[model samples]
Target: MKRQVIVYKMEGSIVRRVIPSDNSCLFNAVGYVMDHDKYKAAELRQVIAATVASDPTKYSEAFLGKSNEEYCSWILNPEKWGGAIELSILADYYGREIAAYDIQTTRCDLYGQEKKYRERVMLIYDGLHYDALAMSPADGAPEEFDQTIFAVNPDRTIGAYESLALNLVKDQQRKRSYTDTANFTLRCGVCQIGVIGQKEAAEHAQATGHVNFQEYK
Candidate 1:
């Protein structure tokens, strides 16, 4: 089906994705940072729980807002959620620094950064909500890569890629050179069928009498 495409502007052009809406979005986002796997999401949750359990000195009651036992109990519960604090724990666990980009405040939050990591992943905060960061070259993704971000400013600054990671840029160069490149599909929100192209997607909307739409990958 026809759908609108999304593009991100970066020094080395990259693409991003939205993730499942759940209490563990931050944790799942961290899991995505490692390898973009959903099965890893639950594993990440358990890792965070265990990390805190083993290092009470680092994640004390003050930081946890409850007794160590209570906090560990809460961590085991899926209904309970995590945030930058969890992100911090995860940053150290991964032995890499993580930056959280808050679009509302236009700032990036740092956690567990030591020199540089083989991979860099970021968590996106849209004011009141959180989403996972799924970035690759706008044109195409590489089999593997690494990154380091030099921020433009305290606000509006985003993650950056190392020169070596520029290899990903060559893979999908035509996918998104401009907003009008139109490398997206439109799916009917009601029926979830793709229409083909932008114009056709629009016509499908009118013909099928479907009002809601989501950008198809």
Candidate 2:
């Protein structure tokens, strides 16, 4: 007869598990910093820099690499980027973990009009170049049309909506006749919501529970 030895511990590319009690020290620190007036966006950047500098091996360029410039540009100039810089930053931070988490932003940009004018500008996970397709708004309808969808990568340590800035959405729509601004309603793909003119979007919402909507004038 042969005796077998059992292993209790395992290590991998990311984190190792020890089955220990949870600690709230890091959480406290995050809250404390956020509560302070000195903790501006620039200050957060400094803190991030310090954290990365102190642990080069853990936070190498290859590990935390992202197009911060592009993201920032979007924040300052959304018209050019189509989406906000904050969204891109979030995507840059969280995009890589999509496969593991099974949760990534589903962004879309619509161009042109009528059926033939519709186009899909983007449909991708944040850190990856591969694109996935969702059924168009016209999927089950009489016509099949395409639309652009670009997801905002969330921060790995801090998921989307954690930042207060995300809540500060300026609902502004330009009109040639009137100067009225309107805020958009955010929905998830997993919800049972329906769109008036787009069946694909409604079907997508039913399947995903959350969906993003932006009407152009």
Candidate 3:
């Protein structure tokens, strides 16, 4: 998403102010300062939800009334976008090596639609002077690795890598559980009576005109 901030066009001395949005990180940061500002977070969440439902033509202002469905779908689908990266490709890109991540999922009602959205939070760095903080629910993916790949802001204002890594961990956990069940079921079936091993099972299945399982062995 293209965030905009207005600054005075002066030549020398330095003084710049940043414009805040409902979805701005400062919105969350204020929580650290106050600790009792849950109301603000709640209010911003609602406004952001609404803006998301409205589908603002310009992303500079507070994104209000936007549906989580739109946000989730937008991230998955590359055509209708806002420049944020997707979780799948993000995990594959950065989580491949470390296997560590920090991703979160939240749900909100937008335009009467309950939407489940995913966001990635991470630390981004460069061998330079300034640093940035960011939040994106997909939409801003790059062109080269577009399909399912999340986009990284050029200035590293946001972190998508951590979220990607978190997603990968969850996926792996689910897959392992599923594989365990499948293996147990196969073992039970193959060890029945005279079925001694994979080869025996295959031979019995073939001789008896049963479906010879290619994946069983």
Query: What local lDDT score does residue 137 receive in model 2, on the 0 to 100 scale?
Result: 40
Order of quality (TM-score): 1, 2, 3
Model 2 spans > 4 angstroms off: 1-33, 36-39, 66-217
Q: What ranges in model 1 sit over 4 Å off? A: 1-12, 114-119, 139-217
Tens-digit lDDT track of model 1 for 127-200:
33355554444456552442323333333333344222232333323333212214356678799888655577
- Backbone clash numbers for all candidates listed: 13, 29, 24
**Cα lDDT tens digits for candidate 2, 1-217:** 8999996542111111111111212212122222322123333343444444556565444654444443333223212211222222222332221211101222222222112211112222221112222223432432123222223332222222212111211110011211112222323333434344345544565566444544333
Model 2, residue 207: distance off in Å is: 37
The CA lDDT of each predicted structure is: 0.58, 0.28, 0.29
Candidate 1 versus the native: TM-score?
0.57
Maximum-lDDT candidate? 1
**Ranking according to lDDT, highest score first:** 1, 3, 2
Name the better of 2 and 3 by lDDT.
3
- Predicted structure with the largest TM-score when compared to the true one: 1
Better of 1 and 3 by lDDT: 1
The superposed Cα distance between candidate 2 and the true structure at residue 38, in angstroms, equals: 8.7
Better of 1 and 2 by lDDT: 1
